[model samples]
Target: MTLLDIKDLSVTFNGTPPSPPVRAVDSVNLRLEAGETLAVVGESGSGKTVTALSLLGLNPPEPVCTTTGSLRLDGTDLRTLGDKEWRSVRGRRVAMVFQDPGTALNPLLTIGTQIADAVRAHERLTREQARQRTIEALEQARMPEPESRLRQYPHELSGGMRQRAAIALAIAARPKLLIADEPTTALDVAVQAEIMAMLRSLCVDLGMGLILITHDLGVVAEQADRVAVMYAGRVVESGPAAHVLKRPRMPYTQALLAATPRLDAAARTRLVSIEGQPPRLRDRAPGCSFAPRCPVAVDDCTAGVPPLAVFDGDHAAACLFADAPVELPAARPASAAASEPGPAPTTDGPSPLVEFDAVDLRYPVRSGALRRVTGHVHAVQGVSLRVEAGRTLALVGESGSGKTSLTKLLLRLERPSGGTVRYDGIDVTRPGPADLRRLQREVQVVFQNPYASLDPRLTVRRILAQPLRVHGLDSDEDVLVGLLRDVGLDSFALDRYPSAFSGGQRQRIAIARALALRPRLIVCDEAVSALDVSIQAQVLNLLADLQAEHGMAYLFITHDLAVVRSVAHRIAVMRHGRILEEGTAEDIYASPAHEYTRELLDRAPGRRDAPVAPRFSAAGDTGLSPTTTPASQHTNKERSPLWRR
Candidate 1:
């Protein structure tokens, strides 16, 4: 049975005065069957979230926003429901799991209290009954020690635990439908697998329909029964997951697949990037919304909007050239030349740019109102690693595995409790004022969220110029323009604020600023994890090119193993604040020595060896072979003594 059906749904947000109303979600159509999963895939601001919000009637009402067309739930019309009616339908019949559980869940309330409150909202149960039901729900969501978690607040739980709690709250009333928006976006690979498995089990056991809103194609491939590809407020394609992923009819879908980094792909392999950004709501042109960015687009594509025409089975595409043969850019070989020439190498031989020697970082665990130190939280322990000049060493680990703490030690943001952090043979655990200034010039960092890191008030020129000014370098307009050009942006972006740019563009601005000081080592702390697949591809390619030209080393820190496969020459697996395994990327992927490393690789989604349909291939491609290095050539240091125990 069709659990939910949406037809010709158009959601528009009204603007004030001179500004025109924006049609955020335009004439979108989708359907979800009982006990089935429907995945909605799209880049940021592509109406995926807007459409999801509409399902719950969360959009602004009246003159502020307008919603039209059919929205039905189990043969009942949802559009006709009033505010009071929606309250009964929301938690009782349908529920939603937001992306960030930290914000979605009240920080002050205990997990049991929040879930019990939600349970009480839709049902007339006694306080004790609601509490018991909360524990049952947590158990159903597969949260460990469900009863013990009741007293813990949101902050007290780990990221995975928080997400599980969020899921439990959503399912407390056992709704017929569940909506998960980027549910596992921020989680590590192992935790993500567990969450996805738990959600699938819930769908089967509860007979609930699920609508998964996400940008990760890997998750879609693994979890989604059907796929809906959205772009610029419209469904560009929709079909069975296999058909859409393997034989994608829409250019946008194909481009997204192509841009996604594959685990099978070799290190330093260039990714295919979409040329332009999605059109702004106000600047939307007529005809196909993706026509401007579509590589196969012709003059007729812009003549008028293309209808979602069904061809092979239920597979549909809103493109004029859906049936025609289209050429997609392939992943370039590792030998591809950089865009510009860089300065000659200053160092000779296999000199280490950055080194962590038996590093141990510990924070004092305080107790009582007096804040007396009772013990220590060992964040990093006996982790010895080195990054050679121009090499990329990927530090892969789960949250709280001491990855950030290691980076902090390297950047001199925190001094190690034990061991030395050396930069070019100089111990940086404690440096003089002059040495500190020099260290700052040579080291730079790019954080996960560019919007949070960048100052919204400052213009792009000012952001880039501030670093140059601090270093007493040439802060002229020409130098700034050159920095922008290096990152594939024009001079017109200089005067615009960070808010005006997309997530990808804001990161480029951040990179441009990082480049201002001519840093030797760039610490990318989960930089591309927040971006769309296409945008991530662009940024990865940009980073690869910059590294090739400038001969700079990268301390690439992330939990994404597929991305690790695409960029890292060496791999270091961290857990419990120690290096569990370290080797060449090839050696680690081919034959992981440690059990933990194998578990990580196994849990990672979108395995090429899976029985699912093959990845979308480019024309005249014989497949890019992964470049490998002998294990003997790449050093594997001794493990920490704690690992033996």
Candidate 2:
């Protein structure tokens, strides 16, 4: 049965007097059925979320764009419903899980109270009844100790735990439809897998219809029954999840897939980046939104918008020339997929520049008035690895793994309880004040959330100059501007604050700050996960170039296996504060030794493609699913398969 349907949707944002209003959403149409998932895949500001918001009449009428559409839920037109009715239908029938749980949840209230509000708003329930259901909701989301979690504030929970609580709140009313917008963006890979599994199992058992909005195509392959590609507020391509993915008909869709880093590809091949940025809702172009960067665009593409047309077997693409074929490079060479190259350095180098010699870190779990350490939380245990100068060492694992803890040890942010962190000949764990200061200068860090790392009140100039001042180095405003420019910012941005910049721009600023100290070692913690495909490409390339020039070592920590495949020289798989396995990127990819590492490889995005071949995995990836189902049904045969490389 059709749970929700949106038809003839259009949204226009008000602009300054000179230009026409920006069209954020065009005549879009979509449908959601019970017990199925519709994956809305797009880059930032492509109108995917805007469309979803419009469907629910959730957009702010003032300041923001006004929407015109027929939004129906179970044959009742939502647009015609009055405010009071909408208030009832919104939470009772359809609920939303926003992107950032931290912001979505209020800090002042306990999680229990927040969920109680949601339940009470829709259903006529007693305070006690709502509280009991709230605890149950938390449990349903797989939260540990649900009863205690309800009393805890949002700030008290970790990223993953907070998100799970949010999901539980959304489902508290037992809504038939759930809109999860980038639900797993801030989570670690392992946590993300758990959440995905929870979502999948919940939907199946409850027959909840799901609208999953995200950038991760891997999520789509695993969870979605159908998929829709959105760009410039328009549906560019769509079909059964497998079909659209396997054989994307739209040029935009094809570009997106090619550009995305695949974990199964060659270790050193440059990312297939689609040049240029996505269009903004405030000032979009007149023609095809993707025309500026499309490789096979023609004059007709710019003349007017093309209608979505059928390609094959339920798949449809908006490109006018969906069937007009030209040769596109295989996604990855088949050979590149099956094997990883050895650690043959680009140049003859001294033994790895940085090595962790049996590193172990532990923190005391305190309790009661005595404040005694009851037991220790083993954050990093007996981890050893080497990072060669000019080479990138990617530490990949799920949450609860000691990836961040290990980086902290390397940077001396945390003192190791056992073993040592060696940089050249020195034991960094016992760094003196002078040595620590030098380490900060020599080993810079780019934090995961640019928001928290940067001072929002400080302008770009001030932010960039703090490190310079710390090291007793003085420079004029011009020098700050130069640093900003070096990281791809313009002089105009120098006066702006952190809040004014996008995530990608903030990251660039962070990188510029790291470079200001002229660091020899750079630590990247989930640096590119928040960015869209195009911006990720630019940052990855810039890092590679800078590494070649500076001969610095990079300690990259992330859950993204796709990026690890492309950028890492050596790979260390961590699980619960222990290094499960450490080896060259090629060996880890082609022949992972540990079961945890194998499971990670399976959960990675964009690994399966057309022309994929079966390969023997004698190393035993016991943690991963052995069944090799076709990842995307619409994938073309031209792309090289990483499995057979």
Candidate 3:
């Protein structure tokens, strides 16, 4: 039964009079059946999110906006519906789980109150009745201690818990359809696996049609039944999830696959990055927007936009040469700069670039009205690590695992409670102002959220030049241009603000700023966690090249094991402010000594050998069914085989 159908859908956002209007979503078609999971995969600005929003009449206000074509739900034309009619259908029939739970949830309200309100709004329920259902909903979402969580505000919960609570609220009234946007973007590998499994299970158990919008192909592979690949506001490819993922026909889709790092793939292999950026919506190139970056482009590809051609049953692609083979590289070229040798291993090193001799970081846990220090939160305890010049040391852990705290020690943002920190054989643990200035000049950081890391008010030129100016160095146009060029950006980006650039481009700008100070060691805190694989590969390659050329060391902190495998020489597995295991990257990957590290490796997506284990419930149950089945046909009795383990 077709639950939702959309055809020839186009959405345009009005720009200033001097600029052309932006067609964010153009000429797209999609169909969803009950219990179907359709993953919409794309980078930022691909219009996947906008398309999802339009289905619920949630697009930004007009005359700044206009949407055309048909959106039918169960044979009812949604476009013809009045505001009151739409409101009736919005939550009771269709519900949406937004990207950021921190923003989606009401910060001021308790979890129970907020969910009760959602239920009350959609159903004729009293406060007590709504509250009862809210508890049930929380339990259904697998939230631990549902009763206690009801009284807690959004800020009191962990990120994963907050998301789960939000999902509970969305599913409270038992909507027939659900749309989740980047549901697991901010979670760790284990948590992400759990969330994906939970969502997949919900779709099966409730028989809900799900439209999942995200850039993480791994999640799509693990959870989706079908896939739609979007690029520059259009669906470039659509097919069975496995078929499209294994043998993508569109050049863009092919590039995305090749760019992603697989856990099964060998370590330190250079990633295949698609050159050039996606076209701006306002530009609206005459030919296929992707032709500008297509690896297999031809003269015909530039003539006109190709209509989607069908092949292999339901599979389709919008490329003139859709039948052409995708020439995915067996491995990145050996001549690639990332493959070059770095300085000797720390064990055989001249003095290490940075060192921590049994460093301990602790925070006083205050409580009550009197604000007494009840106890200490040992953020980092007896952590000893070293990074040789031009080498990379990766710190892998879940949230609250002391990764950030350790970096704070390095940045001098927090002083150690015990032990010592040394740099270049100097015990400048408590550096004076002049020493601190010198230390700051030699150490830099690239944060996860590039926009937040960058000053919003500063232009690209000023952002890059500020570090130079602070260091009493020349801030010439040539210097700024050179910085941009080093990070694979052009001179034209100089005049733009961080808001004007894409997530990938903004990260590059941040990297440029980090490089401006000629830092000896760079601390990357989940730096590429939010990027598309292609952009991530590009940035990793750039970092490798910089390290090779300048003898810079990287203290790489991230939850992504695949990325860590690509860049790090040594690996440290941390948990609860302690290093569970530490060894050469190869050693750790081949054979992890700690059970926790092994579990982390097992949970990493994109692996063919071992399936990710479903998270054990708070009650310590495996939550597995004896059998497995397709999502559409799955019953509560059928769970993924990984769950059985």
Each prediction's Cα RMSD?
7.7, 8.5, 11.1
In candidate 3, what are the lDDT values of residues 1-645, reduced to their tens digit? Answer: 899899999999988899889999999999998889999988777898889999889987778898998999878898888899988888778898887677689999999999998888888998889988999988777777899899899977765678788888888988888999877655678777876787777778888899998777777887888999999999999989977887777877876776776676567766666666677788778888887766556678778999999889999999876776444432343244445545545555567778998999988967789999999989999999888788889999876678888988888789999988887766657777877888889989987656567888989989988888988877887778766755557788899898877555787788788878878889998777767776776677667666665678899988788888888889999988999999998899999999999999888876653222112222222111223211212221232121112
Count of residue pairs whose backbone atoms collide, per candidate: 0, 18, 0
Candidate 3 has an lDDT of 0.78
Error of 1 at 535 (Å): 0.6
Model 2's TM-score against the true structure:
0.82
Model 2: residue 344 alpha-carbon error in angstroms: 8.6
Ordering by TM-score: 3, 1, 2
RMSD of 2: 8.5
Instruction: Write one digit per residue (lDDT tens) for candidate 1, span 1-645.
Output: 999999999999998979899999999999999989999988877888889888899999989999998999999899999999999999889899986677689988999999999999988999999989999999877687899899889877665678788989999999999999877765789878887887888888888999998878898899999999999999999999988887787878877887787777776566777766678787789889887766556789889999999978799998887776354545655554442224443566476889898999998977789999999989999999999777789999887688888998888789899998999877887778888888889989987656567999999989988987888888887778867755556787889898877555687778778777878889988777767787777667766655665677889988789899888889999998999999999899999999999999888889853322233344234222123221111221211111112
Stretches off by above 4 angstroms in model 3 are 81-92, 106-116, 124-169, 333-337, 340-348, 426-429, 474-508, 609-645
Error of 3 at 89 (Å): 4.6
Number of the top lDDT candidate: 1
Model 3: what TM-score? 0.86
- Cα lDDT of all candidates, in order? 0.81, 0.74, 0.78
lDDT of 1: 0.81
